[model samples]
Target: MMSVPNLDQLDANALRALAAQLVGELEQRDRVLDETRQVVAKQAHDIQFKETHIRKLTHEIAILRRYRFGKKSEQLGGEQGLLLEDAVDADIAAIEQELINLGGQPSEQKAVSQPKRQALPPELPRIQVRHEPHSTTCTCGCQMQRIGQDITEKLDYTPGVFSVEQHIRGKWACRQCETLTQAPMPAQVIDKGIATSGLLAHVLVAKYTDHLPLYRQEQIFARSGVRVPRSTLAEWVGVCGVRLQPLVDALREAILNEPVVHADETPVQVLQPGSKKTHRAYLWAYAPGVFQDLRAVVYDFTDGRSGAHARAFLGGWRGELICDDYGGYKACFEQGIAEVGCMAHARRKFYELHQSGKSLIAEQALKSIGQLYEIEALSADLCAAQRQQLREQQAKPIAQTLHAWMMAHRIKVPGGTGIARALDYSLKRWAALTRYLGDGRLPIDNNWIENQIRPIALGRKNWLFAGSQRAGRRAAAVMSLIQSAKINSHDPYAYLKDVLARLPTHPNNRIEELLPHKWQPSAA
Candidate 1:
């Protein structure tokens, strides 16, 4: 082979040009790698699925064989079923581990059984047990002195027992003056209410985070032999929402200050005043600065999915907004807010078309979108300036090429067809779609906000509908704190409990301390 190329021989411009060429080659290689990964993922999914089915059939076969020969079929079925499950889980675990070693994404549906490290809680009360032999005396018939003793600790649990706590103060009287005085009562989340801070925290977490409806919570309380009504719990939640407003306000301010924000909306069912029927409402979610370690998710509840809702939510703050092809957001762009389109949305349109039928145009569009995504995956870990430079060098060309192809194909496709619609959607949003090339901090998609909206969608499926508009507002306020805590990777229950316990006595001016981005456990 000839002598190896040396960087020292290359000048600055030459080195950059060479580097660009190498980056292009690497990008091509990455595209091939990603396609291979997708194929492997699909194959792995199929294999695991087939393996699970085979195991099930084998268990059934064993049971059938037992039934044909003897009377212990029921027992054999149970045993075989459990053994097969364990085998399936172990095999899948090995397969997943192998895929991980090979630097590929594993199929999400695979069942992997990994041992969980179980230990007693460090803070819970523990019990110690001591074991001693009855014959501890020396064999020579002499009494032995105890040298050392062994102790073991274990965790113990007992069913919850309810109790009532009452505060009583003694009255002092000055006989000459005939004056009586007593201590002032301490502040609380609910004044003179039977519920304590801990109980209120549980109710809020259960209702909003855990998706437990008030009626279900009432049933749970009854199972615990408590007689609290569902109405009482609802009142508690509404009160907490109102009290938590100061912190939520601080959260909104912090989020709105960020340079980049992601916004999305989902439909909600609400009962209108003086009307037996329900009206559709919307929950608008705004997430700020997802690139940072600490971020905030703010939810605004509105009566309709109009552009005014987004304008009101993002009042006077001008920055980049990543969203889909929704017409409601057109006004935001019109009002001078820079809009960045979601590549995922564009890809999804083509993905549906590809799945519905085989079309070279659709497949080529998917491939082009995939190339842009590969460039993004490569730049995920770089800083903003570097990432922007990389995008300019690598992603911009692909985007330009894809846009040209789309414009050319849009004219040839028949009107009103799915393929035509996909092409039109992409062509209409071309500027926003290519916005990420200039700003590295902005993602190619609004999946960040979309993810924040998923919980609300799931919640609606269970809670069914909001009692009224007021209830919808309360839900938004409470969900903001819970989801923000989740964004910061803090347990929602613990964060809510800490906030509720302190908000009673915490100063209103310092409510920012209770915001999820700034809040931390007292011990932490």
Candidate 2:
């Protein structure tokens, strides 16, 4: 509010004072500008973070759309399909982690602070609303007579609801006879454990079939007001596996007796005894009859992928063995087993070459392979002898043509390219791949068996690793039964529950009847 003298009219002292004041004002402005820049920088960082997240979500959605609605597997072919699959996998993992975080603090916990209502499950038993009088009397001051009232529903929350089942065995007493008679307690899967058959089945299905790890199940039980621990759930599983061992034995026997079987293996991480680190264990799947035979599959858990493991389980059994190019089956084949190669494996090689934009040699091979499949397609309903004849008439020529084409192109393509690899693969496996043409009983590929073992693959992603070698074998047993049950069109949970209930009482001599193919659900 004070006026300043002009520099030209004032003395040096006044001018010097004004100059110092102006310098102070400039420094204050600089400080304010610095503060503003810091705030802007912080805001810019947050915006960048939000933009990156948005871009990620958008990319994930686009990938999901493409995988769901875009060109299918055959069109996308080999590598391209894998890329899309990986993208979808990343999105799914992100969602799973988000779900895990969400599950940590459930909505029930927040109800104390904010009592927001939600829809109760329709299956829950409900209590009718308690009516209250709106007024003591009508306008005439007379007692109001009873009339129809409107009803409304509101969700009520009960964190956990459970009941204690009182298993009171009937006891008969006669004072005159001075004697007492009581029925013996029924046997359970766990001799001393309090879990029922239904509970055992629920736990088994949750962990193995549904891929819910025991820890997650433990959390679920806590939320449901039960204080079951992961260790206890795991013990139940192990005990159930032991009780079901006889059925697994029967399944293996039935599988080994079959004339044709498909075999495949997948890696599993398992902790070996005396070793702190885990080792890569293999789950060897032997499907007795996938396509035309029985739906039963037996899995052998081995510590290594050696040829000896296949030979050991197979036990010198002579039959047709269909598998991939894994040389581990060489011993089995050498032991008088008819080696059948998967045409699907050969086809996939060519598919990869085509996807790589390599020579048309791969496409030509695929076309020839497709012709063979087309013939098999037409003969789907034919019996074995008829299918054999049909294959000899039509499929034989396709295999022969594909073989000749491979021999011719093997020299043309570069030695290390995809086309060259495909040609070499088909040519090397020419005998085994064409063996399917000899027997209609043989499947075109090991894909069906692969489907059976896919549960183990998906489950491994959730469970991460097995605790021990014995634990891995137990897992194999459950997986074998579950997959066999699935292929036989039986509800796995019901089958397991029934088997667990009856296994203890059922005679070991009649255990074969409890197999997936032969088992009948006992009446409640």
Candidate 3:
């Protein structure tokens, strides 16, 4: 600190200079103080943000715990209830992971202890893995004696069988070395991975194909005498999804090669980043036309149901597209892609009208649609030319009559009425709806693709919503292979197991061979 000069000892110039210096020092101090306040304010804001995040997490934990352990959970029944339980388990684990990331401990509860697990089956085959010290000599120049060994049995599952691995680690004394040595464990698919490829494949098949969530799989595995954590299972899924992407890409290319394709999209919910809220997303599915020899489907996942996504996926491929009346597909049509509208969508409008109340017009429309379907059923097994010829000879007249009836009825009903709306839908797109009559390669409706979309709809019920966009795309890729395998009559588990084991070393150039339609299982 500087000492204050006395006014009597200072000249006028000295006094002015001292005053200027004092003002500069005061200004410097004020700037420092202002910076300090700004820093403090920023820190306070961060603390409040973290505190609010923690509170939100804590609240979510409470709600999930109540759902998991409360009476409301007890009241749930049937297959859906079991699926809900699995979803809850996964959600709880996910939130706990988030809390751990935030440097917070997961909340613990003491109520409702679970029942004891049963023993493994005695019939399952057991494999022995031995662990012994690298050396038996002691550091004191004396040989160590053999000691009793400790064995632990872990339950493992393959596709259709349960097996056990007995790990035997021998205890060796080393008085001279003053340390114990053991054989190093072998490498696995993942570091310290608890599952083998077989088990990983099984878990994946169950989750993506059977619609069994990881939480449910955890319960199933626990009952089998091993309780794998859902988080671990999720890690396995992530790894496998990355590994299998090459094959999914090959499948998509194969689908695009066909002259005619079926395309459809379904809405899915995705958890928004850094928030508890979810946003709407889409899973776009593409497959070869019904007449195409390729038995495969590929899925593209996007965050929104936009036309651009469809254009991007089906880029430059101007094949015939059999789809619904979604305006998103209009851009594709404008690009010179042929459109084959779904007849079932038109039939559905009248079907709904008929179901709601008796309507003579609606009944007549259904009868006409039913006749057209009968003609399609008769030509189901015929060749393309023959089918098209048959449609032209028989179904075209019925369709024309239906068109005339709709046109005549349009003037009778008010524009806003359900019947009028149904008639208008069929009338506006009549040409595209009946395009199948000219080309037998084109499907009569979008039902074939709708069938492909069913698995996703069913899966949504159990998995609830995708955890992230990456997770959603991963699911879409895996399910594409699974569904395609089913389409070709291949068992999903066996196919996945073989593919997972081979994917690590399979040549990328020949990746197409692994697609479901061409895949041949490796010899045992």
Candidate 4:
């Protein structure tokens, strides 16, 4: 090849032009690299979001199927039948196949046909053996004098049955003088009643823990040769609530004393007094950590979503409040409680938008959000202090970048667009959004409260609705106790059974200890 033109030998103007061309090419290469990086990031985000959405939808599908087909085989009403028709079944199968193609599992109809083995008796036979021995002389010494008898064989017995004999002591009057004495009876779950505490405990657990509505429970009992009315069980639950109210109150007090409290609300239908049908209400839950030295969660029910309800529940106490974006909490925050917005809620808005359509704005906003979440995920493996440090160093810059992006693009995007709405939501709550950055103790998302609401949602789907507002409140109170007991890893049925059995006689002053955190198992 011809000798390459020497730039050093060229005039200064030409060399300067060559230098500018080299610089432009280098800058173009950098731009390509950046574009490639953004494309890769977007692809990764899309994959992750799609995978998560699939999981959520799959879970919901399973739950709905359980609700629909898991009900009794009997017809729900005259029009609705339990089994799916051929066409509907085919459609469902086709839909399922499509999902499977997209990596969804085919729903299995697991028929547990147990291997047919010999059936075991509910109770085992009690075996007893006896052997007897008599003194024996050698065969040759038939006439030997009688020797002391020896007991060679033995008989063994075990008492297989236990009998409880209740003694109602009698009062006796002396023949010569009038003198009467009688002993008082010990406390029990029910006085002059046949059922034991264990049975009542089962009933409470079946009704609340298992989400078997009292009416359904009554039907089940009828199958077992008992004829209890649904109303009777409802009355029983109400009576149990009345007896256990002190414990619930104590738990509330303890929750109020906590340093960091989490609160959430869900709708409940209640049979309000004088109403033709059940009315709408809410059950608000509160949980505290550190302040009350509690590792337990508590729930409270109210007939309304008014600030008064939260104020009453919180009792004017001030601490970190972890909650969603419900306006009802505005009052509490206004009154001096530090409010931390849940990032899960913020992420959810964009997630919903993304599912509705792959709108560019929603995608962009979500990618921006992904950056923050990625930081959170990485920091999960770090200790609190390290996480705080990482957040300050790594997360702060990302957040600032996002802020700058939002500001630059906010006006260019239309107001009603999904991404624009998401951006506005974050911008409006920007202060609360950044609150986690300031403290390591705070969570990045409101998933705590979201998780708290899941059980109620499941139960609601089962029962459909409450009979009335008072009934709804009752459900809330009972659920509060049950779920709090669950959070503390206590046996809910056993705890409720004991609470119901003891509250009638338990001293009111220390009832708070019966709350999940303070509860101790009764001495053996």
Report the lDDT tens digits of candidate 3 across residue range 1-524. 36778989999999999898888889999999999999999999988887788788788768766766777534355544544444455455556555665677777752354333345466669889898777777777778766667776655677566787777877766666656545555444444445566787798899988877777787887676666666557657766776787899889889989989999999998863233466899999999998888999998999999899999999899889999999999999999899999999999999999999988889989999999999999999999999999999999999888899889989889989999999999899999999999998988899998999999998888777776666687789999999999999999988988887677667889999899999999995
> Candidate 2's residue-wise lDDT over 1-524, tens digit each?
24666668978888888889888888999999999999999999977875665555445444443443445632233433332232232233333223233332111121122223333345545555233444534444454444334343332222244333334443334344334444455666666565667677777787778877666776787676556645456556766776776788889888888898889999988753223356798999988745556779888899999989988888958988889999998877777998889889989988887887965777878888899889988987888889899999888877777677778778777798777777888788888888878787877888888988888888888776665565677778888888889888998888887888787788889998889988788876
Window of ten residues with lowest summed lDDT in model 2 = 105-114
Residue ranges of candidate 1 with Cα displaced over 4 Å: 1-183
Candidate 2 lDDT at 435 equals 84
Best by lDDT: 3
Please give the CA lDDT of all the candidate structures. 0.71, 0.70, 0.81, 0.62
Q: Which stretches of candidate 4 lie over 4 Å from their true place?
A: 1-183, 289-293, 378-386
- For model 4, how does the per-residue alpha-carbon lDDT over 390-484 read when each residue is reduced to its tens digit? 89998888888887888788889888977788878888887888888877667787776667778887776666555444345556677778888
User: Which pairs clash in model 4?
Assistant: 259-291, 270-468, 270-469, 271-468, 271-469, 342-446
lDDT (Cα, tens digit) per residue for candidate 1, span 374-398:
9888988999899999999999989
| Model 3 stretches astray by more than 4 angstroms | 1-124, 128-156, 164-194
lDDT of model 2 at residue 339?
89
TM-score of candidate 2 against the unseen true structure = 0.68
- Sliding window of 10 residues with minimal summed lDDT for model 3: 109-118
